[model samples]
Target: MPDSGLEGLLRELSPQVLGALVRRYGHFDLAEDATQEALLAAAAQWPGEGLPDNPRAWLITVASRRLTDLLRAEQARRRREDTVVQWTLPEEHLAPAADRLAADSDDTLILLFLCCHPSLSPASQIALTLRAVGGLTTAEIARAFLVPESTMTRRISRAKTGIKTSGVPFGMPPEADRAARLDAVLHVLYLIFNEGYASTSGPDLVRSELSAEAIRLARIVHRLLPDDSEVTGLLALMLLTDARRPARTAPDGTPVPMSEQDRSRWNSEYIAEGVALLSEALPHGPTGQFQIQAAIAALHDEAPRAEETDWPQIEALYELLLRLSDNPVVSLNHAVAVGMARGAREGLAALEKLDDRISGDHRFHAARAHLLEMAGEGAEAVESYVEAARRATGLPHQRYLHGRAARLRES
Candidate 1:
């Protein structure tokens, strides 16, 4: 890891380094605090001091020192005179990066298990993973989720405190528990990718860093747990989505509607890999939500043009997906597919059913606007477009929405 790009460097090593510290100290909460302090210290020092030959080792040494200080403070409060002075860990344990090849696999896996502990709620698991494993600050995670920084701060704090009480052991779990914990891990990774792929609310349409990091972590999972079908499915989904990165937006940061994106510019390499992975995942049997979603993305990628998309198959897949996931967003997408497969009126009717449930969602209004335009109700469509623009949070979405209304008005 080069010292010049410390942010990305720290993010990449966060899980591995933090894992080592937590495992050595047997204090997840304290280790996380110390790791964060180490990162902050590095941010301030490494630039002026020059990059260390072994950056990970430097971080481990720094965080371990912090952890030792914390332990000494706690021991002083207890007035334990003998143990406080005697407390010491093996020096080799503090310098984990010296033997990373030996520790990487187990340490990273254990860190993930702790971050995705079953006792934590799904929200907490995602927050903790981003903060601890993903090396995202509480503020960045808050922005990703469209929540206030204060709220996110409390949420992460609660998660850390709750886990301390949960009494989870470090390292591997029993076979039965492994499956459930890994499920949470996959969910957090997908959420991170989705935020980066299509930002929830921000000036930019995409945050490539988050998506790229998610892909890196997913690849790690795929490498270690090759037999896990959902792992393959998720990696495929992310790659397929990421393949469109080059064409997803225009030069000015406005989103290029899916129909307008140039397929020639799409990342063929990622698409090829995604296609191969999806093929492998399908044979594993029992298609999951991730598999179904990946299959849908594969269909679109398989097409040469928007007109060539298999709408009926996509509609069918969306229907199956909605059955598996009672998510309102899935229902909204199903309605979009219905419009394309059936007619604008049919799509409008389907979308209208979800209006009450998804009224506040910009996509709900945007879909209605598109359907209305297709139905030749330009005036109504213009109104819908404006409404969608008003509700839209992403700058690109807002630009596209307002542009749609402007075009409709001109016509």
Candidate 2:
């Protein structure tokens, strides 16, 4: 294989290989180091020898060897108890095809659990998971959080140190602790998808890469815990939302409201999958926030035209969501449905009640602006759009707000 192809293969295979390595070594730091060394070895060898049939397996073998060498060297230097023995592959385990899929799946889940270790702050867990598990660059993670690259780097480093010092186990948490940790894991995955669905601060309106990563994570979580209703709901929500990605932006990267977006452009396959998942999730007795949100998205997807939308059903779903999760965001979203179902004035009134609670959120202002525009309060609408644009973090969103305000001003 050519050098470029080999490099590409290495990049693609690194995550799985590293996950396995971490499982073997019982430390993220060691897994990362060993994976890097394996890549270097591959760079020197694969070009001359050709790509291996099983690239991931090949990388795992090389990384395992590299880890053993490092541990032996460390033991000699410190005269300390040898930790390398733990990483040594047994002769019985040498064949990569043997339990490869099962091992990889377990490793990936374990890596996620490690990233969500309770000792680190939630922000650090998200930042680290985005960087490590999602394979996002530090710059991308930093942009998502509106932080400096250096600061994100420090946060990731601290997170790694925290994991090491806290002696957090690498594999899946026990059944008792799984419920408690599930929220953090789900929240991290949600944030990843949201960043991908609508980039917070980049030139592009949609970061498909990030969105794809999030969807992949959600699917993995669903597979790992198939009976977990919230996991199923999250998968359904993401699929439903992702189905409309093609119609969510203009060719120029401007925002396209759902009412104006072309339904024909939406991915029917994803919509079907989302609908099926939602059906499966609904029978689980009680619904969670994700399930309610998925129901709302499904309501929109089921409509052939904007006027045909079941606004009352959507309003009811949002109301249920608000009940399940008393978040200001939920209330604000519910207000949009109320406005569409009842009238702009009703929506405006509902939004106004949320002002004191969600004044700092730009979306709250943007929603109010849209409602006011529909209400013919052009001046107030323009002011609200201006405020939303001022507080907006992403370039595309800010531009969209400005354009909306400018159009209203001209009218």
Candidate 3:
């Protein structure tokens, strides 16, 4: 009765069962609900009763029965007896779920594409992705974004309706529509990874499990679309950045800044692999934002010491990044690089330009505080640090910022 084993198997089974129901029934909403119920039944019954011989078939039969029952009830209420389809439930169960379902099934990929359908807005796409594809509960997704459960529920409902109304197929999207859909998919994946990389609201600074899950998903996407430069770039960026995971926190799980991290602890193997990935993607010629960011990270990985970092090149790459993406987050990081390459004054000036959009962000205040500190504006730095600590969501970061503010005030 290994809990982790059961949970992992259930997670894998969810998409396939849900996808099969969706494909057969053509009712994504109903199929999703039924699949969840089937999973719930398994969770309750499997541990005590023991694993069934055919876990997937058991799930499918149960979920299909549930779906059929619902449809039958609706049809009965509507007096549409002609449309009612009868299905018999399987009485059997599993022996240890199969080792990986059919690879060519494309069920997961289709589910992902539908979740990120262009008909839905980015926020809606994210909500759907987290719920349907990421296997997150509605409450968990709501907590992650600090949105109301009712609101997220509506958002997910609306997204599904949009997909239905837009006639989004439950199969691979056409080539002409794929680029845009894939962008949304990548964004969702990155968002998931970023949450795992640095949770917005949590006691722990790094949600290691979540980050690792993100990487696993990224590998899935890379495997599916091997030739796409952006795919390689995305994987490379994640690997390059995640290579520093071991040194990101202290033994007590306290946050550690990049500058103070132990270089020896950084995974050299991940760095080499990431470097190879970025190198391959780059020669294909600047595919997108991920590649450029990977390049910047590669430069840092190549540097032997903090003082030896090629700040000038990093600064230039950030500038190029700003051109490609007008994202305020990019601006914030670019300003930090500018500060390092040039000076606190130049960095502060660049940061000032982003105050309109980024002023309220905790990272903005923290970055501004650091720059002010370097510029010898101790009082201003302390004030900014205090604000950052106040606004910060992650407890680990809040503690770090508070400590910083205190030291600056004492000095």
Best by lDDT: 1
- Worst 10 contiguous positions by lDDT, candidate 3: 89-98
Predict model 1's lDDT versus the native: 0.85
Q: Model 3 over residues 244-266: C-alpha lDDT tens digits?
A: 88899877666788888899999
Query: Weakest 10 consecutive residues, lDDT, candidate 2?
Result: 90-99
Q: Is candidate 1 or candidate 2 better by TM-score?
A: 2
Per-candidate TM equals: 0.83, 0.85, 0.81
Order by lDDT, highest first: 1, 3, 2
Worst 10 residues of 1 by lDDT: 95-104
lDDT of 1 by residue, 276-379 (tens): 99999989968889999999999998899999999999999999998788888999999999999999999999987884668788899999999999999999
Candidate 1, position 112, lDDT: 78
Best by TM-score: 2
Q: What is the lDDT for 134 in model 1?
A: 77
Model 2 alpha-carbon miss at residue 390, Å: 1.8
| Candidate 3 Cα errors over 4 Å, as ranges | 1-3, 37-62, 80-105, 139-155, 250-254, 267-269, 390-393
